[model samples]
Target: MIRSLRGRLFLGLTAIIILTGATGGLLVYRWAFREAAELQDSVLIQLASLAQNGSFSSGRPLLGVEEDTDVWLIELGATPRGPADDRQLFGLKDGLQVVMRKGQPIRLLLRTRPDGSRFAVAQPTAVRDDTAREMAFRTLLPISALIPCLMLVTAIVVAHSLRPMVRLAGNLDARRADDLTPLPQAGTPSELHPFIHSINGLLVRVGLLVDQQRRFVADAAHELRTPITALSLQAENLGSVDLPEEARGRVAALKQGMQRTKHLLEQLLALARYEAAPAERGEMPLIALDSAVKQVVADLLPQALDRGIDLGFQLVEPHMVRGEPVMLATMVRNLLDNALRLTPRAGRIDIGIYRQDEAAILQIEDTGPGIASPDLERIFEPFFRGSSPEGDGSGLGLSIVKRVVEGLAGEIALENITGSDRSGLRVTVRLPLAADRPNEVSGAA
Candidate 1:
């Protein structure tokens, strides 16, 4: 009924130890009791032999043969001498017998002398039983003491034996969601080999399934792009044809829809490609962090001008980070696009890139309505727009940005910039610096 393996093992072991100890203790006690009784009878026999040999006079009783042994020598002559109990004992043949004397049970050893006289060595039955019981209990002292020590050793051994399982659980819990590495079989108990092997096989199958899904998404997106482009071209061609005002409006809306669809397909393709890419640091090339940020901002400059939003770098420093250049560029573009779409006309967006703590840090701050607190946790989820989403965004921007950042061994954090007269979202990214970077310090521009 125990739910935990440790509890069950401990309880089972403890029960076995207790049962074994009890059984062994009972056997030893019984054997020691019998031996003590036999030995006491032999002592009485030896005392009776000594009395028959005339070693001592029998007119008086002998006492204290040894301390704590209440054996005594009684002279009962050939016939009964004193009490009726003694008379009854003298009438019996020579040897050991149990009888009542003075209304108390006694163990009497009877013997006849060559002179036609008789004497007996008698001991109280209670005293004999008490001595035997004490000796028998003494025999169990070792086993009783050994039981607890055995239980302690059992507990220690159980914990030690189950430690590997505990460590395995912790390792699995700490692993990344996408990590498909097999559990190591080394140092594990042979008994658990089959279980671990099955788990590794499951991981391999799951990884394959995930890779296949990614490829399907990428392939589907690639196949859809050509037709979507052709449709967009057809819509663009309709722009030159002379059409009524109502038809013109319809054509314009169609063109906008096509543009949105194309953007969605592109985002999907990027997401699938990034997810499918293996996260291998050695395969990634070093890229200038500032240069990438500057290029993305310049590309969006026209859109910023059209909206009168001041999109420029507040701080720039020469720093190198390890990542695929295209993926890095995609990440920057998505972040900036999201900011541009949210910020109103005349809004300001500032970008900062610098080296901090052996990492390349990129910070983007925008003068737009900050994201709601409840939406922050779910913002990075694919196709998850906030409650008050703006523009025709595909909602994959932040998701792609998150994937790229994680792929490059970096961390991204988003927070609302709070202070007096300020309400905007601030994005901070920290990526591990590439090796072989110059030691020269570069001032922020």
Candidate 2:
């Protein structure tokens, strides 16, 4: 499991302070101990020198002599023979531990006279004990008191450094689900800005998808309810039909309306699926524009012939685009289907492919009751109905066309081809040119 950033930072900062304090403490201790030993050695050497050179006030032998008080000096022969003599000589030194029967640890200073006789002066360990203790206490005691203060300061610094992250976390925790706005992190560290920016991007995308879903659901319900209610009414009417030609015609019209409603619902479902995907639309068939258009026209030609409309193509060039063949075909079929259904008998409809400015353009123009200027853009929205001669459409057709064009990174635009009365609807589609195709005609015999 991942630990929080604040906790990790605090731990790391505290550890650094601890290491620094430990290193400083070790150095201080070493310096204090070495200085103590040096001071003791200097003081003892000086006292020993004074003892060797100076004489007593009485001018007699101060060393190896007894005194009225315990404060007296002692001088011992380097090679003493008897225990009694050594015990008597040991009493001369004041407050010194001297074992005359063995070697003693004392700082000795030697003085030489003109007669070449040597006198030795010694200060025993007790002479400098109190001074050494005082020096050690003075040097090391303050450092011992500083450790706690250092720890407190380290903790404070760590807390201060992590306060921003704490606030950021709290801000995030208190947010509502509908909050798509960015987190209010004005003073955030540079190290975390990329993460913040990435999250904001995610929020934007998710918000868009959520809005789209809401619209889809609302529109689907509104469109589906009308047909379902009509069907229910039709079923009621079925029980009361004492059939004449007029009654049968009403039933036939009702059945056709039901079929149209079902078709519209299916189309809406497809549009929803296409919009809900989070990733790129997957690969589709490599279809030639001419062939795909020709096929759709072939399928719908019978209806056109029945309406006495002349549906023809202008293949200025053969161009191919990458798309889901089914979706692309649907898009073309819907556009042409709307045109054929709306155009009056003897109306001429043109399907043409041409290139302009390095893009493949498919133009579908029909001399039918063209869309009004205001309704051109609105017609592409789902379930929209235009005041025209054609039967009411599922309204998903144009929307499906738009979705397919966007999925393939293409564009669509409509213009009124009529001279003055807004009588012809012209739709132009532009697709990107293929980049990795061989320079030869494809699917050519």
Model 1 TM-score, all chains together = 0.78
The number of clashing residue pairs in model 1 is 0
**Compared with the true structure, what per-residue lDDT tens digits does model 1 show for residues 1-445?**
6799999999999999999999999999999999999999998887787777766655344544875676777778756778776687778888899988788888988888888888888888898999999999999999999999999999999999999999888999988678899999999998888989999999999999989988898999899999999999999999999999999999999998999999999999988877876569767766778877888888899999999999998889888887887888999999999999988899999999988888889999999998999999999998999989888899899999998898888999999988898889999999998875455322112
Off by over 4 Å in 1: 1-10, 39-69, 113-117, 155-174, 181-190, 236-253, 301-317, 342-358, 365-378, 386-390, 414-426, 438-445
Per residue, candidate 2 scores C-alpha lDDT tens digits across 1-445 of 4387656765676677667767776677667766765665554344445555445322133444333211222344443334673445433443323333235444433433344333344444444444455665676566667766766776777777777777877887866444577865589887677878888889889888888775777587567868676785776678587888888787877777776766777677666655555234335445677777888888889988888899998664778777666677778888998888777789989988988887789999888767887787687776777655358578788878887787777889988786764477788999876643545323311
| Lowest-sum lDDT 10-residue window in model 1 | 436-445
Best candidate according to TM-score: 1
* CA error at residue 26 for candidate 1, angstroms: 2.7
User: What lDDT would each prediction earn against the true structure?
Assistant: 0.87, 0.66
The window of 10 residues in a row where model 2 has the poorest summed lDDT is: 65-74
**Alpha-carbon runs more than 4 Å astray in model 2:** 1-242, 278-285, 387-390, 420-422, 435-445
State the displacement of the C-alpha of residue 107, model 1, in Å, after optimal TM-score superposition.
3.1
